[model samples]
Target: MIEIGHTPAKRLVTIRVSGKLTSKEYDTAVPEIEQAIEQSDGKLNAVVELDDMRGWDIAALWKDLKFDARHFDDFRRIAVVGASGGEKLSSKAAGALTSADVEFFLRDQVDKAEDWAAAD
Candidate 1:
Protein backbone atom coordinates (compact mmCIF):
# COMPACT_ATOMS: atom_id res chain seq x y z
CA MET A 1 0.00 0.00 0.00
CA ILE A 2 1.07 3.58 -0.59
CA GLU A 3 -0.09 6.93 0.63
CA ILE A 4 0.89 10.42 -0.48
CA GLY A 5 1.11 13.50 1.67
CA HIS A 6 1.80 16.88 0.11
CA THR A 7 3.31 19.72 2.06
CA PRO A 8 1.23 22.81 2.75
CA ALA A 9 2.88 24.69 -0.08
CA LYS A 10 2.84 21.55 -2.15
CA ARG A 11 6.57 21.74 -2.64
CA LEU A 12 7.14 18.43 -0.98
CA VAL A 13 5.62 15.04 -1.66
CA THR A 14 6.01 12.21 0.78
CA ILE A 15 5.08 8.68 -0.15
CA ARG A 16 4.69 6.04 2.52
CA VAL A 17 4.76 2.42 1.51
CA SER A 18 3.62 -0.64 3.37
CA GLY A 19 3.56 -4.29 2.37
CA LYS A 20 4.43 -5.48 -1.10
CA LEU A 21 4.61 -2.96 -3.90
CA THR A 22 3.11 -3.63 -7.30
CA SER A 23 2.38 -1.78 -10.51
CA LYS A 24 -0.83 -0.67 -8.87
CA GLU A 25 1.12 1.15 -6.19
CA TYR A 26 3.12 2.99 -8.82
CA ASP A 27 -0.02 3.82 -10.73
CA THR A 28 -1.58 5.32 -7.65
CA ALA A 29 1.45 7.34 -6.54
CA VAL A 30 3.05 8.57 -9.75
CA PRO A 31 0.33 11.06 -10.57
CA GLU A 32 0.59 12.63 -7.14
CA ILE A 33 4.33 12.95 -7.51
CA GLU A 34 3.95 14.54 -10.94
CA GLN A 35 1.40 16.98 -9.64
CA ALA A 36 3.58 17.94 -6.69
CA ILE A 37 6.52 18.58 -8.94
CA GLU A 38 4.42 20.70 -11.24
CA GLN A 39 2.88 22.60 -8.35
CA SER A 40 6.29 23.29 -6.87
CA ASP A 41 7.47 24.95 -10.07
CA GLY A 42 9.72 22.00 -10.89
CA LYS A 43 11.32 21.92 -7.48
CA LEU A 44 10.34 19.10 -5.18
CA ASN A 45 11.32 17.16 -2.11
CA ALA A 46 10.31 13.52 -2.37
CA VAL A 47 10.25 11.41 0.76
CA VAL A 48 9.72 7.70 0.30
CA GLU A 49 9.14 5.36 3.22
CA LEU A 50 9.24 1.63 2.74
CA ASP A 51 9.67 0.55 6.30
CA ASP A 52 6.85 -1.95 6.22
CA MET A 53 7.12 -2.88 2.59
CA ARG A 54 7.71 -6.52 1.86
CA GLY A 55 9.00 -6.18 -1.68
CA TRP A 56 8.21 -5.01 -5.19
CA ASP A 57 7.00 -6.54 -8.39
CA ILE A 58 9.04 -6.72 -11.57
CA ALA A 59 7.15 -4.10 -13.59
CA ALA A 60 7.47 -1.73 -10.65
CA LEU A 61 11.16 -1.54 -11.45
CA TRP A 62 10.43 -0.01 -14.83
CA LYS A 63 8.07 2.45 -13.25
CA ASP A 64 10.86 3.60 -10.95
CA LEU A 65 13.12 4.14 -13.93
CA LYS A 66 10.45 6.10 -15.69
CA PHE A 67 10.02 8.27 -12.61
CA ASP A 68 13.74 8.92 -12.41
CA ALA A 69 13.86 9.85 -16.08
CA ARG A 70 11.02 12.28 -15.70
CA HIS A 71 11.91 13.85 -12.34
CA PHE A 72 15.61 13.39 -11.80
CA ASP A 73 16.08 17.13 -11.90
CA ASP A 74 12.65 18.38 -10.92
CA PHE A 75 12.70 16.32 -7.77
CA ARG A 76 15.85 17.85 -6.43
CA ARG A 77 16.05 16.00 -3.11
CA ILE A 78 14.73 12.57 -2.11
CA ALA A 79 14.59 10.89 1.27
CA VAL A 80 14.58 7.14 1.06
CA VAL A 81 13.45 5.26 4.19
CA GLY A 82 13.96 1.62 5.13
CA ALA A 83 17.01 0.58 3.21
CA SER A 84 19.26 -1.25 5.65
CA GLY A 85 20.84 -4.53 6.71
CA GLY A 86 21.88 -5.15 3.14
CA GLU A 87 18.72 -7.03 2.43
CA LYS A 88 17.69 -7.77 -1.12
CA LEU A 89 15.12 -5.00 -0.95
CA SER A 90 17.77 -2.60 0.26
CA SER A 91 20.18 -3.69 -2.43
CA LYS A 92 17.55 -3.20 -5.07
CA ALA A 93 16.78 0.24 -3.75
CA ALA A 94 20.44 1.16 -3.72
CA GLY A 95 20.75 0.11 -7.34
CA ALA A 96 17.64 1.93 -8.46
CA LEU A 97 18.75 5.08 -6.68
CA THR A 98 22.12 5.17 -8.43
CA SER A 99 20.66 7.46 -11.07
CA ALA A 100 18.61 9.50 -8.64
CA ASP A 101 19.51 12.27 -6.23
CA VAL A 102 18.35 10.59 -3.04
CA GLU A 103 19.46 10.43 0.58
CA PHE A 104 19.15 6.90 1.84
CA PHE A 105 18.32 5.96 5.43
CA LEU A 106 17.42 3.05 7.58
CA ARG A 107 13.88 2.54 8.86
CA ASP A 108 14.78 3.83 12.26
CA GLN A 109 16.26 7.05 10.94
CA VAL A 110 13.13 8.94 10.11
CA ASP A 111 14.29 12.11 11.83
CA LYS A 112 17.54 12.13 9.94
CA ALA A 113 15.74 11.41 6.69
CA GLU A 114 13.43 14.34 7.27
CA ASP A 115 16.38 16.55 8.03
CA TRP A 116 17.99 15.58 4.76
CA ALA A 117 14.77 16.12 2.88
CA ALA A 118 14.37 19.55 4.39
CA ALA A 119 17.96 20.58 3.82
CA ASP A 120 18.98 23.18 1.29
Candidate 2:
Protein backbone atom coordinates (compact mmCIF):
# COMPACT_ATOMS: atom_id res chain seq x y z
CA MET A 1 0.00 0.00 0.00
CA ILE A 2 1.01 3.65 -0.43
CA GLU A 3 -0.02 6.99 0.87
CA ILE A 4 0.74 10.23 -0.93
CA GLY A 5 0.96 13.64 0.62
CA HIS A 6 2.63 17.00 0.10
CA THR A 7 4.95 18.89 2.35
CA PRO A 8 4.17 22.34 3.64
CA ALA A 9 6.30 23.45 0.75
CA LYS A 10 4.02 22.43 -2.07
CA ARG A 11 6.80 21.53 -4.45
CA LEU A 12 7.78 18.55 -2.35
CA VAL A 13 5.73 15.34 -2.45
CA THR A 14 5.84 12.64 0.19
CA ILE A 15 4.98 8.99 -0.46
CA ARG A 16 4.68 6.39 2.25
CA VAL A 17 4.95 2.78 1.16
CA SER A 18 4.11 -0.31 3.13
CA GLY A 19 3.70 -4.01 2.31
CA LYS A 20 3.71 -5.21 -1.28
CA LEU A 21 2.73 -2.40 -3.60
CA THR A 22 0.15 -3.27 -6.23
CA SER A 23 -0.40 -1.96 -9.75
CA LYS A 24 -3.60 -0.35 -8.56
CA GLU A 25 -1.64 1.69 -6.04
CA TYR A 26 0.84 2.77 -8.68
CA ASP A 27 -1.99 3.67 -11.02
CA THR A 28 -3.35 5.95 -8.30
CA ALA A 29 -0.08 7.33 -6.97
CA VAL A 30 1.74 8.17 -10.18
CA PRO A 31 -1.00 10.50 -11.34
CA GLU A 32 -0.74 12.44 -8.09
CA ILE A 33 2.95 12.91 -8.66
CA GLU A 34 2.31 13.88 -12.25
CA GLN A 35 -0.16 16.48 -11.10
CA ALA A 36 2.38 17.83 -8.68
CA ILE A 37 4.93 18.05 -11.47
CA GLU A 38 2.41 19.79 -13.67
CA GLN A 39 1.49 22.25 -10.93
CA SER A 40 5.14 22.95 -10.28
CA ASP A 41 5.63 23.78 -13.95
CA GLY A 42 7.47 20.57 -14.81
CA LYS A 43 9.72 19.96 -11.82
CA LEU A 44 9.23 18.76 -8.27
CA ASN A 45 10.99 16.98 -5.42
CA ALA A 46 9.92 13.73 -3.75
CA VAL A 47 10.48 11.90 -0.51
CA VAL A 48 9.50 8.23 -0.32
CA GLU A 49 9.14 6.70 3.13
CA LEU A 50 9.34 2.96 3.15
CA ASP A 51 7.88 1.01 6.05
CA ASP A 52 8.24 -2.73 5.80
CA MET A 53 7.71 -2.49 2.08
CA ARG A 54 8.69 -5.93 0.75
CA GLY A 55 8.66 -4.93 -2.91
CA TRP A 56 6.41 -4.13 -5.82
CA ASP A 57 4.13 -6.47 -7.73
CA ILE A 58 5.20 -7.28 -11.28
CA ALA A 59 2.56 -5.05 -12.78
CA ALA A 60 3.42 -2.24 -10.38
CA LEU A 61 7.07 -2.60 -11.30
CA TRP A 62 6.17 -2.16 -14.96
CA LYS A 63 4.09 0.89 -14.18
CA ASP A 64 6.94 2.32 -12.15
CA LEU A 65 9.38 1.94 -15.02
CA LYS A 66 7.00 3.63 -17.43
CA PHE A 67 6.45 6.49 -15.05
CA ASP A 68 10.15 6.94 -14.55
CA ALA A 69 10.83 6.89 -18.25
CA ARG A 70 8.09 9.38 -18.94
CA HIS A 71 9.14 11.77 -16.16
CA PHE A 72 12.86 11.17 -16.04
CA ASP A 73 13.66 14.84 -16.05
CA ASP A 74 10.69 16.15 -14.16
CA PHE A 75 12.16 15.54 -10.72
CA ARG A 76 14.72 17.76 -9.08
CA ARG A 77 15.49 15.52 -6.12
CA ILE A 78 14.36 12.19 -4.64
CA ALA A 79 14.93 11.20 -1.04
CA VAL A 80 14.30 7.62 -0.04
CA VAL A 81 13.74 6.85 3.64
CA GLY A 82 14.28 3.29 4.62
CA ALA A 83 16.61 0.96 6.51
CA SER A 84 16.49 -2.08 4.28
CA GLY A 85 19.53 -3.09 2.24
CA GLY A 86 17.57 -2.90 -1.00
CA GLU A 87 16.78 0.76 -0.39
CA LYS A 88 20.35 1.83 -1.12
CA LEU A 89 20.46 -0.20 -4.28
CA SER A 90 17.13 1.22 -5.36
CA SER A 91 18.39 4.75 -4.73
CA LYS A 92 21.48 4.13 -6.84
CA ALA A 93 19.36 2.69 -9.61
CA ALA A 94 17.05 5.68 -9.53
CA GLY A 95 20.00 8.09 -9.69
CA ALA A 96 21.39 6.26 -12.66
CA LEU A 97 18.08 6.14 -14.48
CA THR A 98 17.01 9.75 -13.99
CA SER A 99 18.42 13.24 -13.72
CA ALA A 100 17.14 13.69 -10.19
CA ASP A 101 19.58 13.74 -7.33
CA VAL A 102 18.79 10.65 -5.25
CA GLU A 103 19.64 10.23 -1.60
CA PHE A 104 18.97 7.53 0.97
CA PHE A 105 18.25 8.09 4.63
CA LEU A 106 17.88 5.72 7.54
CA ARG A 107 14.36 5.35 8.86
CA ASP A 108 15.07 7.65 11.79
CA GLN A 109 16.21 10.43 9.52
CA VAL A 110 12.95 10.92 7.67
CA ASP A 111 12.84 14.54 8.80
CA LYS A 112 16.21 15.11 7.20
CA ALA A 113 15.03 13.35 4.09
CA GLU A 114 11.99 15.56 3.86
CA ASP A 115 14.14 18.65 4.40
CA TRP A 116 16.55 17.56 1.72
CA ALA A 117 13.76 16.91 -0.74
CA ALA A 118 12.26 20.32 0.01
CA ALA A 119 15.56 22.11 -0.20
CA ASP A 120 16.16 24.84 -2.72
- On lDDT, the leading prediction is 2
lDDT of 1 by residue, 1-120 (tens): 889999836367888988888998889888987877778865787778876677789898789877776655676677778765554356456545544466678878887877787666
Please report, in order, the local distance difference test score of every candidate based on alpha carbons: 0.74, 0.87
Residue-level lDDT tens digits of model 2 in 10-107: 58888999999999999988888777788784579999898999888999999898888998898998999999778888888879778999999999
> Which whole-number lDDT from 0 to 100 does residue 47 have in model 1?
75
TM-score of structure candidate 2:
0.93
Q: Could you tell me the C-alpha RMSD of candidate 2 in Å?
A: 1.3
